[model samples]
Target: MTRVKISRVTKVPASEAPPASGECPPSGIRLTTDDGDAAMGLRVVGIHLENCGKQDYSVDGYPLLELMDKDLSPVQGISIVQGSGGISTGTGFDEPARPLVLKPGESALSGLMWRNTTESGPTANIPYVRVRAKQGADPVTVTPQLDLGTTGKLAVRPWTRPSK
Candidate 1:
């Protein structure tokens, strides 16, 4: 099966992620929503992944999204991975999956939140993110690749700045 890379972005101020200690799914990734405390004042309005596609794959080894700072650097974060062609509860997004085989025009949507790890300060500045799909040598059929994230339709009030 052919493997491809998937990508996405978020423009809103990311909220702190809930602890992963007892919050993950048995089979899939775990995501906790910590609507940032009053200290940082960083509120996660919403996270939108536009067009997401994965090749024919299995649910065992799905791709994971790693958030980055304004410099296109990696920011420690957690991702919500799920299967393809399914609806994710709470948020109206698609479940991310592995070896995901998509027909033409099919896509998935993944949600994410940033957690505050630094002591007494604002959270990291997250502009864009990189989602890497691990590869496995399996005979599983796959689908065509699609784009992901806020496809140029982002609006972050009071936080928007000119791109570098």
Candidate 2:
């Protein structure tokens, strides 16, 4: 069985400029703050999934991605909002379990919104993120050393067809 891998997970700064027309961004993951206020405790995290295996792979239901804490456990009160319903770009509003096929060397981009509820500052404990192709598949967990400041609500987007 082929296994999907997490090539890289980057923290996109709000100050980063958008891509030029018809041009793709550098990192697969994009992070943006709501209301231009990173201190206000709202962030949007985007991810690009690359297929590095020799065989093709399939993903469904938001790619089953999760932001894990230091102990490899999912944070509390984080809501996963699947991008299957056209709520975001790339993902389509079709079946809940839309099969996203990825050939070798291909990649797909997805977004997730994180909202902080607690008054605590930055989650220094969170050091890694976990991802899987689908349910029952072996999850590929990696410590990208991402600093998710404090705890909050996370709305995840599903994996979709790669844009040409």
Best by lDDT: 2
Stretches of candidate 2 off by over 4 Å are 1-40, 84-97, 117-125, 143-152
Worst 10 residues of 2 by lDDT: 28-37
Q: How much is 43 displaced in model 2, in angstroms?
A: 1.7
Backbone clashes in model 2: 6
Model 1, C-alpha of 150: deviation from truth (Å)? 24
Q: Candidate 2 on 95-153: residue-level lDDT in tens? A: 35467777766766565545444565654445556655557654445444544345443
Best by TM-score: 2
Candidate 1, poorest ten consecutive residues by summed lDDT: 138-147
lDDT of 1 by residue, 91-157 (tens): 3223222344333223332333222334553433454444332333211111111112322111111
Error of 1 at 7 (Å): 24
Error (Å) of candidate 1 at residue 11 is 14
How accurate locally is residue 159 in candidate 1, as Cα lDDT from 0 to 100?
Answer: 11
